[model samples]
Target: MQKEEFIAIASKVSEGLATDQQKQLFLYHLGTFAKENPEWEKLDLGFRQQIEDEIKSDIRIQVFGEAKWKPKTTRLWPRIVAIAAAVAFIILGVYFFNYRNDKHLDIDNLVMQGVGPGKNGATLTLADGKKILLSDAVKGQLANEAGVSISKTEDGQVVYKVVGVRANEAGKNNTMTTARGEQWVLELPDGTRVWLNSASSLTYPAFFAKTGSRKVELTGEAYFAVAKDKLHQFIVKTKGQDVEVLGTHFNINAYPEEESVKTTLFEGRVKVSPFYTQGEALSEGEKATVLKPGEQSVLANNTIKVLPANTEQALAWKNGYFMFENENIKSIMREVSRWYDVDVIYQGNVEQKTIEGTVSKFKNVSTVLEMLESTKVVKFKINGKQIVVMPGKDNN
Candidate 1:
């Protein structure tokens, strides 16, 4: 394409008017020049301005370098910073969002400890008041209550299949809880799939509501792919919020300790209702706010705040990784505390420290700690099941 055409389309991209296809073409042209020109920093009049000039010019045509591969647009935003960040993320193998904006870490001065990561383990509390440790339950039938067969699958899932009737008996409600260092997947009788994160619990019925919608209570974080039943909506109720869906996929983090409950919709749509008065009477006339895909609803201060979501980052745990962007030290360590089954103790004022990176949750706790230490802002010490997060060597 000619320079005029490239400029026109690129202007639309900067203004957020270009479609994904147009953005892909622009990214290809820009990413190609960026790769070819490795000396951008040396001749940079700010990275964005230099990139715009090179993209419009045939720097490749000067030598007319052979075109090789096309740059795919994984994400796009109107700002130039966002575009640059996305391209850099593509180059670095991490989902690029906001970059780090805190005090730089002193990576050379750090301490590390080795603690194993959390694994698949949970406890299922049957309606009959029997507690079965799922981690040790040999793959077979676990229990049968109200004609619903409960089994432990080979892949560490708790499956509930209806054998006879879909009854909402008073004594047929089941609860599954994961400890600090545990996680599990649950398949309901109606075919909806739920992935429960560490230190979480899900209380569901033997069968969905016989008359109205399917209902479940949750604590902690969970990802849900609700099975479609247009006639009976699926409702996820937590301490502070209720999410209603017909047939959609969404995630909820409603740990009671958290200041707010966050609900992010990845695919399909969901209606989120944040409670203003806890334990307030709820009649069938209660209303909720609808959230679309790529949107998140934050229930805090008894208000619902909707914002654009980074679905990839939100679903990172389900994908076997812990991803963060500009997150404070305490928050990151809290995740560490849950996954590694450890308690976090702060030495002094360390809340100002922040990090931006991605690391596999499958690794030993030391690997994650080391990644944080590399930022040079903080260091950690492991004493049995207690982790003491203190200032870095530089701070010392």
Candidate 2:
């Protein structure tokens, strides 16, 4: 385009009367002009002087009158000022719109709203079928079974130590089970660590066998940190599935109420499949959820989905907190009831409501429920140990 035409377009852009297409063209020209005129050090001053001179000479005369200030029927100065204001608004609108849209595209908010740590409550079952309330147990050695000394740590971990037994003869089978309102931590003979969730049990030899694979059976949910032993593969056998790993940390959710057994691998490799199936393996950063024998690692519909391992949420119970990220009221209550040893009953159709936050397990059940109710979605009434969850009315 001619310099006059370019200058006119630039003037229109400066006055905010240019269309989007025209503004784009003006920006292109301005870029090229800047690149070609590298020696123009006083760039801003030069442009301002040029615009000021043009506005005073041409635009001013067109708007007001000649230099002598002759009164004219049409006043152009007001229109120019209005146009300039409009242009500034348009520029600001475009910048803010783009910025807001980019922020809306981020996934951080969504992730922050869903999934959290498990709650407290884990019981222990003695060999003679007697149950011991673990959560209230005094911190020290509770008992010894066979060659293993079972001690409850100050942090509420049920640690099993091999005593008065040869390392080679360490594999005497002992089982530790947690009741509905409890969770437990066990340290295996090979230095492997297991965090047992509420309503779960882990069966392993008192001392790991020196020869074959170190295997343990689990029910419900547990987080495992397998000790490194290439020669002795560590295997976790649940009701329908088994996870085999050399050394790694992962979580296994094999709840009977849930249809699938989910194994989330956080670090290292693991092979997970149904107890009867063979050759099916899930690598690191992958979750193997077995619904049935032949079904692959997949979340079919909303009923059964195998999500990638969210370590913080999956092992939150082990870390002494309840973390909920966009978790539905029903699911959240299920966890709350399990850990606090309470029966949760819903008074209305409030399953659709969800909560997102983290709370310390050290807090009592009522305190945690109060925090959840603060979100204004649900309310709780504690009758004895039973918690009645009801939709909060406008007043409550």
| Model 2 / residue 68 / CA error / Å | 66
Model 1 C-alpha lDDT per residue in residues 1-396, reported as the tens digit of each score: 554465555556644576756765666665554454432322212334645654455433321334432233422132342443333332222232223454544443333355677878899998878999999999989998877889987766889888886654423589999999898888998899999999999998877656787889999999998999999889999977789999888999888777788899988889988676557875442446799998998887667888999776787676566778778878888788888888889896776656687665666776677667766567777677777888764344
User: In lDDT terms, which candidate is top?
Assistant: 1
Please provide, for model 2 over 84-143, each residue's C-alpha lDDT reduced to its tens digit, 9 standing for 90 to 100: 322222211111111111223211111112122234445666555556666677889887
Show where candidate 2 strays beyond 4 Å.
1-172, 276-306, 392-396
Give all TM-scores, in the order shown.
Answer: 0.72, 0.56
Every candidate's lDDT? 0.71, 0.59
After TM-score superposition, the amount by which residue 394's alpha carbon in candidate 1 deviates from its true location, in angstroms, is 7.4
